[model samples]
Target: MDWKTITQIDRRYLYIILFIFVSIPLLSPLNLPILVGEHAQAMYDTTETLSAGDIVVCSFDFGPATIPENRPQAKGFLFQARELGLRVVATAFWASGGPLGEDILRDVYGSDFPAIPEYGTDVVYLGYIPGNEVGMQTFGDDTWTAKGTDHYGTPMADIPLMQDTRAAEDLSLWCEITSGTPGEQQVIQFVQGRHGGPAALPLVVGSTAVSVPGMMPFYAAGQIVGILNGLSGAGEYESLLAGAYGYPTELLAPLDAQSVAHVIVILFIIAGNISYVLTRSSGGKEK
Candidate 1:
C-alpha cells in the first residue's frame, strides 16, 4: 500500500479490528496464563492468615462505574473469607457501595456452594453511611453507633454478627474495594491511626487502575498489607481463588478478554511501525 494509505488507515477499520480482538476472547476465552503479582499474592496471603471467626470489615468504597474491576476482587475475598469461616462485617463509605455489597453477598450465598453460611450470623451488611471521612471515623469509634441499622433497616443490636463486634479494634482485617479517595487514606487516618501501638488493624485494598499508582506508596510502607489493581489484579485473584478453593476457571472470562485485547493493541502498534518503516524505505529506493 502507498505511504499515505498505510499511515492514514481508516479509523472505522481499526475499530472493527479492535472489536473482533476484544470480542473473540469473550466468546471463547483463551485461558491465557497470568503471572500473579506480588500485590495480589500478598492479598491472598494476608487473607489466608486470618483465623476462623475473625471479624473482617470489608468496605465497598467504589461506585457502580467500577463494578467490573471491583466485583471480582470482592467475590474472591468473600469466597476466601467464607471458606475459612471468617465473620464478614460489610459496609460502605460511598452511598452506592452498600447495595453492591448486598448484591455480592446474595450471589455468593446463592451459588452452588452448599456449605456457605447464612447472612446475619456469618455475614452482615451495614450499608452506606453519610459524612465521608467523618463517617469513617465514626465507624472506627463504634460501628453500631455510626450505622444504627443494617442495610435492611434492622437494628444493629438485632444482628447476630454485630453482637460482639463494635469498632475497628475488634476487626482482624480491613478490606477496601475502592475507585476514589476517602478510601485507603481515610482508612489509614481513622481506623488504623486510632488503634494503639503495633497492633493496628491489617488492611488490604482493591482499586481501579487509575487509583493504583497512588496506593502503591502505602503498600510499600506496609500501611496497607495487599492490593488488587484493576482487571488484571482481579484476574490474578480469581486464579488464586480457583487454584486455592476449586472455583471455576470460566469465571475469568473478563481477564482472558483483557489479556487478548492488550496483546491486540500491542500488535497493532508493532504493525503500524513496520508499515511506516517499509513505506519510508520504498520511497527512498524510488528516489
Candidate 2:
C-alpha cells in the first residue's frame, strides 16, 4: 500500500476495522489475564472478610448513562457478597439508580445464580431516596427514615433484613457503585462521617474512569477501603472472582472486547505515525 494512502485512510475504513476488533472479542470472549488493581483487590478482600449474615449496604449512586461501566462492578460486588453469604441492603440516591440496582440483582442473583440469598429476607432493595446528602445523613441516622419502604413498597419493618438493621451504623460494610456526584462524596460525608472512618463502616467505592481520579484521595486516606475504577477495574474484579472463587466468566465479554479494542487503537496509532513519517521523508527527497 502507498504511504500516502496509509496516511490518508478513510475514516469509514478505520471505523470498520475498529468495529471488527470490538465485535469479535464480544461475540466470542477470550479469557484474557487481567492484573487486578490495588483497589479491586482491596474490594475483593473486604468482601471476603464479611461473615455470613453480616449486613452490607450497597448504594447504586449512578444513572443509566454509566451502566456500561458501572454494571460490571455491580455484578462483581453482588457476586462476591452472595458468595460470602452476606446480607445485602440495596438502595439508590439517583432516581434511575433504584431500577438499575434491581436489574443488577435480578441478573446476578436471579435464575442465573440460583443459590443467592432470597429477596426481602437476605437481600432487600430499599429503592431511591431523595434529598441527596441530606438523605444519606437520614440513612445514617435511621435507615427506615430515609427509605421507610422497600423498592416494592413493603415497609422496612416487614423485611427480615431490614427489621434489625436500622441504619448505616448497624452495617458491617458500605459499598457504592457510582458514576458522578451524590455518590462517593455523599457516602463519605454521611456514611463514613457518621462512623468516623473506614475502620468503623468500611467504605468501598466503584466509580467510572472519569471519577476515579477524584476518589483516589479517599482511597489513599483510608476513608474508603476499596475501589473499582471504570471498566478495567470491573475486568480485574471479574478475574479475581473467576480465579479465586470459581465464579462463572461468561459475563465478562465486554471486558474482553475492551482489551482488544485498546490493542487495535494502539496499532492504528503506530501505523499512522509511521505512514506520516514516510510521507514527509518522501516529500523532502522530491524537493
Candidate 3:
C-alpha cells in the first residue's frame, strides 16, 4: 500500500490496533520482574514502622477519572494496613472522592476480608466536605466541625474510632491518594502543619504522574513522608502487599498486563522512530 494510503487510516484506528495488541499480552502471561524503587521502598518502610494499634488516616482525594491510577495504590495500602492491624480513619477530600473511597474499601476489604471493619470502629469514612483547603484546615483543627458526620450520615462523635479523635495529630500517619488540586497542599498546610511545625505526624501521598513535578518539592523537603506515583508505584505497592499476606498470584494478573503493555509501547515508539529515519534517508515519506 502507498505511504499516503497507509497513513490515511484514522489515528484512532492505530490506537485500537495497539490496544488489542496490548490486550493479547495481558490475556496471556508475561512474568515481568518486579523492581522495587526508592519511592515504594520508602512507602513500605513507613508503613512497616507503624506500631500495633497505631491509627492511619487514608485520605482519598481523587476523582473517578483517576481511579485507575490511584485505586490500586489504595488497595495495596489498605491490604497491607489491615495485615499490620493498624486502625484506619478514611476520608475523602473531594465529593467525588467519597464514592471512590468506598469502592476501594468494598473492593479490597469487602469480599476478601468480608468482615468489612465496622465503620468508626476499625475504620471510619468522613465523606465530602466542600471547603477545599479551608475545609482541610478546619478538619485539621477540628474534624467534627469540618465534617460533622461519617459517610453513612452518622454523627462523627458517635463513631467508636473517632470518639477520641479530634485532628490529624491523633493519627499516626495520613496516607493521601489524590489526582487534583487542594490535595497535597491541603494536607501539608493543614494536617502536616496543624501544630505549626510540620505536624510531626507522618504523611504519605499517592498521586498521578502529572502531579509528580508539583509534589517533588514536598518529598524533597521532607514535608511528605513518602510518595507512590502512577502505575509503577501501584505495582510496587502491590508487590509488597502480595508478599506480606501471601495474596494469590492470580489476582495480580492486571499488574502484569500493565507492565507488559508499557514495555510494548516503548518498543513500538523505538520502531516507529527507526522507520521514520530510514524512510527519510531513502527520500520517501514515512509509511
Candidate 4:
C-alpha cells in the first residue's frame, strides 16, 4: 500500500468503512467505557433530592426525529421518580412531543400506563399543549386552563394526578427533555418560577448533544441546575442509576455505535494529517 494514499483514500471507501464500524457496534455493543460527566451527575442529584409526594413536571420538547437521544433520558428520570414514589406530570410544547412523552412513560412504567393504567393515579399526561411559550406560561400559572383535557381526552379535573396539582408553585422541580426552539429557552422565558421568583423554580434539562453549547449559558448562570446531554450523556446517566438501582442499562451498550463512529472519525483525521506531513517531507511523491 502506498503510504501517501492515506491522505487521498476514496471517499466511498471511507463511507463503507465508517458504515461497517458503526453497524458492528450496533449489532454487537462494545460497551465502551463511559465516563459520567458532572452535568449528568447533577441531573441525578436533582431527582435524588426530591421527597416522595413532591410533583415533578416534565416538558417533552422533542419529537420522533430525536427519539434515540431523548428517550433514554426520559427512562432515567421516570424510573427514578417511580422508585422515589414521586408524582409526575408530562406535557409537551412541540406538536409531536405529546405522544412521545406518553410512550416513553409507558415504556418505563408499564404498557398499561395511561391506557389501562395500573399506575395512572400518580401520573398525568397533559399531552400536546398548543401555542408553545404561551401555553407553557398558562400551564405554569394554572395547569387546567392551558388544556382542559389530556392526551387521552380525559378532563384535567377528572385525572387523579391533576386534581390538586395545579400551577408550578405546587411542584418541586421542572425537568425538560428538549430538542430545539420553544424548548428550554421558552421555559426560561415564560414558564420558569411561576411558583414564586424568590428563587427561580429549579430547572433540569435533558438535551440533544447539538443543543449542549446553547444550554451551557443557562447552566452556568444557574438557570438550569442539571443537564443530560445527547446519547452519551444518557448512557452515562444509566450507568449512574444502575449503580444505585441495580437496573439494567440498555443505552450504554447501544451507545457503543455512536462512540465508535466518533472515534473512527478522529482516527481518520489523525491519519490524514500524518500522511500529509509525510508526503510533504518526501517532496510530494507517493512512497
Can you give the TM-score per candidate against the true fold?
A: 0.88, 0.86, 0.86, 0.91
Q: Candidate 4, residues 1-287: lDDT per residue as tens digits?
A: 66677877788999999999999978888777889999999999988988988888888899899999998988888888888889888889899897898888888878887665534477888889998888889988888899999788888777888886788788888889999978888877777745564154788898999999998988888888889999988888899989999867888556888888899999888888789888988889644
Q: Kindly report the root-mean-square deviation of model 1 from the true structure over all alpha carbons.
A: 3.7
Q: Residues 228-264, candidate 2, lDDT per residue (tens digit)?
A: 9899888888889999888776546888898888899
Lowest lDDT sum, 10 consecutive residues, model 3, at 1-10
Q: List per-prediction Cα lDDT, in the order shown.
A: 0.83, 0.84, 0.77, 0.84
User: Candidate 1's residue-wise lDDT over 1-287, tens digit each?
Assistant: 45435556877887898888888878987777788999999999999998999999888898899999998888888888989999998888998887787788777777532234577788887888887999999998988889899877889888888987888888899999899867988888887888741156988999898889988788877889899989899888888888889966544678777877788889878777777787676674312
Residues 45-106, model 3: lDDT tens digits: 89999987788888889888988789888878887787888888888878899888888888
Q: Give the runs in model 3 whose Cα sits over 4 Å from its true position.
A: 1-10, 111-118, 196-199, 249-252, 275-287
**What is model 2's C-alpha RMSD?**
3.4
lDDT of 1 at 117: 56
